[model samples]
Target: MSDAAPLRIPLRPLARILHAREKGENPDAIERENLRLRHEEMRDRARVRAEGRILVLGAVFTLAFLTIGVKMWMVAESEPAEPRTSFAGAGIVAQRGDIVDRQGRVLATNLDTYALYAHPHQMVEPERAAEELVEIFPDLDQERLLKDFTGSRRFVWIRRKISPEQRQAVHDMGEPGLLFGPREMRLYPNGAIAAHVLGGAGYGEEGVAAAEIKGTAGVERAFDDYLTDPANGGKPLELSLDLTVQAAAEEVLYGGMRLMNAKGATSILMDAHTGEIISLVSLPDFDPNDRPNPPTEGHPDDSPLFNRAVQGVYELGSTLKIFAAAQALDLGIVGTDTMVDIRGPIRWGRHTIKDFHWYGKELSVADIIIKSSNIGTARLAEGIGINLQKQFLANLGLFEATPVELSEAPSGAPLIQKNWSELTTMTVSFGHGMSISPLHLAAAYATIANDGKRVRPTLLRQTGPQDGPQVISAAAARQSQRLLRQVVTEGTASFADIDFYSIAGKTGTADKPKPTGGYYNDKTISTFASMFPAHDPQYVLIVTLDEAVETSGDEPRRTAGWTAVPVAAELVTRIGPLLGLRPEIAPVPLADITLTSN
Candidate 1:
């Protein structure tokens, strides 16, 4: 309204002028619209991009959570591992095997037990704890316990092999530092029944000494390595011993020792065919459970722990005469019908060999064995010569120890070392001056019973073929058996003759030599070596007593017939039925097998 258009213009020019003005005024509006449209387009694209990112993140999180859950489940479903509970105490002894008798009876067994230990550092009121322990275990040393408790030790064994009641009492006390460890203890149930054979146990149920019972004597010492092996825990060891037969033998031996007022006695039974030791008994044996504690002043007689059957050696008198006679016959120097002059004593060097019963004239070999004539034996030995006698004795296993699962001294002295003069030979022929163990006598008689096959004796049950050397000819052994049978039937060992069972045996009574020099006439060793079912022998029994005195009121002198022979007879009577040997009389020989002097 204020300004007037100057010039007269065409319509087109005017419109153009108006359009230019409109374009100038509205330039900001067009730029604002373009900016708003561009902003709206960017917002839509950003929303889609944000939504896509959120979806991708959620998928990734879900996958990772699933993977972790699967892994966790897998880890939780596995099998559980075994707990470790091995022996980790001070000594750490592994468990051992079981010891069983012939009939599978448990002789020795291991029992699980608990031992109490203390961690002294963790203990509260150590002195009080010690006092409490002493109260529960009166035998425990209180002073020692207090000292051990107060000492600077991480661990200390309070007591071992604790009973269940003891363990419960300790736990109820709620004493800190107390710990329990599982242990095994060896136990002998039969007590003293077969103590000598089974032996005893040590602390923690281990085998430890000798007849001293520390794994020192008998089968305990012999089989210690096997019994203690940790790999064979709970396995049983079988012996060839028959407990019934052993009890019978022990009864007889104990009776004889008591009857004769003998210092000590020993007896053994062996299978003649297999050489299995069925029974072995030595009087004055100790209980395996209450083994003597190193021979203190408390125990003096406990020194007899030595096994007499395998360890003791004695001058086995007339019993050896059978071997001498067999030697003469085997060497062809004498026969059953051979005759020898036995008028009086025969003098050789400083020693004079005398006959107990002097036959005024000549006597046959059969008469010699029946009468137990010393002069007749000397005559026969003289004919055989010393070398031949020595050789024959060696073959009979007299020169060496009988092979058994035991420690023993060898039989017979060194023949070469002993002065072998004519007097030595003569006296030895009648079973004097030469010494051997009871086991040796048993083995030799077994040879006679087995028809000359000298099978070695064994404690272990035989599982394989025989491995012993033959010793004598069948004919020679038969002759010896015949003579021995006659000795029991009509000679000195008549007491050993059983009514139902044919008996073959020899009687021996010799003076035990004094430590100084000659034999002690007052002290005598009596022995009886025997076999049953004489015609077909099965078992051999030997009984021996040292320093026997006759108190039976029958005989003043302690002879084999009175002491050892009676014991052998009793043993045979009791054990025969147990061994399945029927009491039937053996038939007489087809030919009269008699012994003759040489």
Candidate 2:
């Protein structure tokens, strides 16, 4: 690969110069010609290099211009598409975490769906399209649809969410103006089952392509950030609710409500050890799939949307009597056999605390609870004093709301007397001066059932017992449990006595008050708070009925003993086995049968 070297000729070589000088007319002329030729050759080489560089630069410029022109032509001639708008910050997250029961059954989940909209200007027949759409969705008004379609507006929303069948119907209409935007909707497959617990979700920050699913109530609202968080990678939120147990409890409660002729009812089944809510039902419940709007007038609680189990606070009547007894015993102010005078009406400054029936002049502390004597309990609580009463109730989570995983919990704060006088204390001892939710009663009873470790109710599943403060000694709780057992056996809650379940509970019947300040004689809030397998309890069940009356007797009766207690008994009989509870059957007598070895 060697190349030949170019010949080197000097512009004014000595041989040429000398020969030219010998034969030429002037030596200067020959030197001038050679120098001129060298200059010309330099100019020609510079022109050739400049031409090459200009060709490369021209090609680059031409290619760039050609590409831009082609892109402009393509965009101009092609059909227009909806422009996608991008924001500067984080976008709306369309996916939400699934809500499942503890057993992994889906309670709430997302469904891939579409939203219907229209470009009014693009429609071939606006009137026809409106008519057809109205037929597809009867809720849509034909006049409104026609007005929007024929109006000057470019776009109109037909429906935020449409089923696949509806989408197909709209597509068959052959209306080019109509369109569907992809969407992910919240779907509760079980309809109304566990509706209050799952709450409901709604659209937020909507767009043509997708919509945000935001929790509106219940646990969905409580755990909104957790459910919609993208970092969790769609891990399901597992609740302690047992789907089978919940369904069973609801059926039994609904039947009981109808049979008892109650206007409304609520039931709560909670774990004694872990404070987990297994099944919380508020009757006259709405499906999360079709959640109703809150009322604007009258009593908002009268609406089906109200969550009575957590948000409805009322005087829980004699159900609260156990707290007075338990606190008195824990403070060493009273014992099981100690006799106390429960004489006539306990009068204090214009208010009188009276018993439902006269027991005697004096009754034992244990009999005070079993017989549910208002005067006896007032006498017992008087020994505990006012400050001690307030502290003990606060310790049992009665001064405030139950911290269950529901957004409505904060609204259920117990109504305590601000001006707590001695009259307030005595009347409250009989469960009249204060109002509390069923959830509060369940938690307090759960504390007693959990041996006074002070369980705070939760809706999440747990692996071990809660680490609550020891509000009272286990000995004191055991004595309270014994008294509650006696209530079911020989007291007002005798209807709750089931041999197999060994139920222990207390009944509460408070007269519903008028809005103007007096109490109605006919209306009562009947409640039964109970725990099963009493010897070694594992759960607490609280059932409350608003304005319930039992007509099974000769005359109509509005008492927890007749209405709420039987409902609780039926609920236990139904869900007991489903909760993996075995009946505590009594052993057969020795003389009745002979045992044979296998």
Candidate 3:
């Protein structure tokens, strides 16, 4: 094969020979054979070129698939991203709108927690599980828990709110019955700071998969519809309360209550201009976070659950004299200089009105307020008469429910005798026969302080100028302020006088009515109703103690000046600076001020 030489055809001769074969005409045989060889070579070259193109396309496809696979591997190896959630979706905490103070401090809010549950039917070694649980939570009754664990129930609450540690312990127990799920719990961040004002939220029906909380009392109950509505739940509810003022008032009031060995106490601080409640303290307040169950037996009426500020109605004692004097002044029946003979007790049809301390002196209208004279006040009330006194009390909101933003507020129509006897007029004038809520008295004082404007007391923050109707002439209100100032400088409420703050207030010590149908001379409701910065009159604060008893070795005095006045004074001292009040004691002029009886 190496010795034989192959012959190649020339271009023109090979082409012609191929054309002759196609026509079936015979030509040179050598050229025809060469042409056939050339044509075979060309077909082979074309086949090789087609194979090269297909191999290149396959390589490109392979590269693309390899890149895609590498990307998928990278994604799988990385940590998975968290899934987004919404309130409307399950497993998300759904709660009421937040309750915040005027400064945006959260008063009431929701806390996300785990609710422990169990499936007794699925439990294995339930005795062991109950034993372990009781070890974790000593409060859980072992016997009761053992019963729940061994029962055939599908689901049972082990605990409402459990810590992460407790949950891990339960999970580690390897018990099939133990389980935990998401829950929303209403939390009062300040604990019992404003418990009575914020109230509390209660859980929905038992055995419900989804837990819902509804407001039960106080502002929570009052604004439940707005708070629970999905559209409004995101927006916070703002209140007029100042936590600093509230804390101060509570500290002083509670101190006084305990020191006096009193039954209960209530204190209120309100803005004179807008009637916004700055602070309201009712002692023995329940913790809104964990409200106690109602007592099984005994009198529910004696329960601390009652809000003494607005829900309680009391005689309010000589505090009502402030209103009586104001009414007298407004009606032009008595001027500050007008004199009244209070040396003798005024005898009515079935009763006699006498001052607690008879000085046998004639008292002016200012002196009547300064001395808190029941006899003088009764004489003035007699002049105003029953109808005018009724109208005056009505205007002051004593004849109706306080329009405060509380659902539990009392609709206390003043406890009045329907007969409207002369004796009733005398007693009512000195805050004896008629009973009214402390809030009613506070609102009335706020009216006098706000230049005779009748303001509707509000818990919501005020945004605009209050459109309160003018209840008395500004001139008369000014005169009333002067007399009120004298009450602190030279009158009965000297103990409440903060020299720097120019405090003006009234002291009231009323005999508490016995449940057995008579007044208790030994027990009394001592109260102080006051306004600070007397000349400008910005805030009205009222402190009341139920059944205050004096233990001071000097005397067993159950009077407001001895108990409530000092409380008010201390509260003002603490909160005045917080409220931006400067203390500059300018001595009140005493040129014509006198309280001598004829």
Whole-model Cα lDDT of every candidate shown, in order = 0.77, 0.91, 0.83
Better of 1 and 3 by TM-score: 3
Model 1, 408-431: lDDT tens digits are 334223233367777777787888
Error of 1 at 47 (Å): 34
Model 2 C-alpha lDDT per residue in residues 1-598, reported as the tens digit of each score: 2587566456677887789778866767777888888888889989999999999999999999999999999999998763322345557778889999989999999999999999999999999999999899999999999999999989999999999999999999999999999999999999999888888999978999989889999999999988887667679999999999999999999999999999999999999999999999998999899899989898867898899999989999999999999988898988999999999887776767788898979999989989889999888778988888998889999998788889999999999989997777888887889999999999999999989899999899899999899999999999999999999999999998976799999999999988788899999999999987788889999999999999977999998999999999999999999999888889999899988999
Q: Order the candidate numbers by lDDT, best to worst.
A: 2, 3, 1
Q: What is the TM-score of each candidate against the true structure?
A: 0.74, 0.88, 0.80
lDDT of 2: 0.91
Residue 403 displacement in candidate 2 (angstroms): 1.5
TM-score of model 3 (CA atoms) = 0.80
Ranked by lDDT, the better of candidates 1 and 2 is 2
The superposed Cα distance between candidate 1 and the true structure at residue 120, in angstroms, equals 4.8
Q: Residue by residue across 382-479, what tens digits does model 3's lDDT show? A: 88898988877777777778878887775444566678877788888888888887888899988888888887788999886476888887878888
Query: After superposition on all CA atoms, how large is the RMSD of candidate 3?
Result: 11.9
Candidate 2 wrong stretches, greater than 4 Å: 1-88, 594-598
State the displacement of the C-alpha of residue 425, model 3, in Å, after optimal TM-score superposition: 1.5
